[model samples]
Target: MTSSPAAPGSRLASRLGFSDRVFIGRAARRVADQIEAGLDLVENGLAEDLRVADSVADAASRYLYEAGGKRIRPVLALLTAQLGEGNIPAVIDIAKALEMTHLGSLYHDDVMDGADRRRGVPAAHAVWGNSVAILTGDILFSRASQLMSRYGDRAIRLQADTFERLVMGQLHETVGAQPGDDPIEFYINVLADKTGSLIAAATQGGAIFSNAPAEYVEPLRLYGEKVGVAFQLLDDVIDLSAKPEETGKVPGTDLRAGVPTMPYLLLKTETDAASAALAVQIDEGVARIADGEDPAILDQPLAELRDHVVTQKTLELARTWTRDAIDALAPLPKGTVREALTRFAESLADRSS
Candidate 1:
């Protein structure tokens, strides 16, 4: 399983960087170079995009950006943009918009989850309270829209669709499993909407804005969504496996929050009385922690759940999704971009094992 936490983007970045013994072709290196150069522009533009005339809005908008991130979505956009003119002005703008949207969501997530930290710093909500944190998210969404406005109707529509899916995912997650609903399937769908949709949009926007062939558009979108699923599934494994220092968050934060992970959900599928008892213990512990009791009470349950067979099942599912993501690339033409994409998908699976 995931024995240690890695830097946010380092797994895929290493693949793109050609860290393996197999020599990356010249074209692959060129695509990698283009992405590297584009990242600088994205970083600089992100700062400017988050700036505002109002001092509080400016600080709040820039808070997470300053804390730093893997910038995986934006970099994926830049990489796919190589299918056409690399780093076109429109591509840069789209990358910035997608990143802004992600940052905006994180602000809202911290508030909803009552998270204490993000990116190794205190969460915006923890520092500024819920109202300010929510407003900060709104400000970033507004800025993202402003950036998208530069691209006209099609871009605006795409942004709206992605935003809709993002909100709907959070809503479903908050409302939770309905009567007779398959919790496993329900959770997977939530992940697709929450994490996958925007990532798909990011890569699709890159291809569209860069004027890449129409055929590549759908394939990239599919690839992106699957990759996003794989990424989050690995995160489920990492949340239990990694130390706080490694992941930049406390182990079992989701458990303490009473949020059901894939592993927990899978365990719920078990019919054995022993499994049932463990699940009950975990549910009780999570409920206590959520009700403001000492989180230390969860230590035993969390440890037991982490080492369970269900956790291994979750890791295997993550690998299956990663394989499916690579399969989505079958339609793309043989080139460095396609190769890099395949490697990126594989790298995600490698994280879980």
Candidate 2:
């Protein structure tokens, strides 16, 4: 029932359209490859640090080194750098710092979410226990700060602000999950920190690395924020629509966790009766699941919710955000890089998982 990863090359061709695709086919890969190489440097940098630590560091290294994700932050950074005659090494350092912070957050997030798996493997907290996992996350965060500081005052300030935004975003989500939280407002606020901050940091950091003007930085920041929102919307959609094999995590996990995502928000707006019924089902299911009761009883209802309502609405919202993201890029000079970025935004809207 799970879907396969769309071929990267074919996906680029399809999304970029014929004329743009030809150019992006060459340029995007170059940028993406550079980003991957930069990420390798980051991994090596971390490994070097770990080598000097005690036995506890080995456990932390093992947890942090697991493979997952597309390194999109670093890719964005590299592409932004390529937009100008930027310092590539400095940009890579910043990108690596951002990724380390992100990965650290994920370690803590798994602990908070009580998630058993990440990318189809046991989560750090699940395998290493809460104490080691928490310490591991802290270590990564500390190292990220140390790394960013090496770039001097400006980079330190930028990274500090980014981390602040990240924390605020997570805090908003935690508070927004209470019984009476407005779903629409909740999702917007949550994503601004949880997803938007890092993306904004990625693009803005890129702009900084290039020493671009304020006008350029603002647009890139807006573009990144919009894209981040779109990406998270698609993620919410996938949680409902994708199978375990495709997503590498259980489907309906959001509902299972009582997380009110955009799809649930759209469902709330569609019909009062349906929303009320769905709410009851969710509440009951969450309680039962928490109590070690049968979750199978809720499966049919959740399926109906996904098929009959959430998917279409979520996709539409994602498309809207993607359009906004593209529009934010309007002021930037037209080039293969810009074109490829636009195409990438579109693909984010359409991706299956």
Please state every model's RMSD to the true fold in angstroms: 4.5, 4.9
TM-score of each: 0.93, 0.86
Tens digit per residue, CA lDDT, model 1, 7-49? 3543334433234422276866667767767877887788777
Whole-model lDDT for model 2 versus the true structure? 0.72
lDDT at residue 320 of model 1 (Cα atoms): 88
Candidate number of the best lDDT: 1
Q: Enumerate residue pairs that collide in model 2.
A: 169-193
Note the clash tally of each candidate: 0, 1
- Cα deviation at 164, candidate 2, in Å, is 1.6
Top candidate on TM-score is 1
Error of 2 at 55 (Å): 2.1
Alpha-carbon deviation at 2 in model 1, angstroms: 33
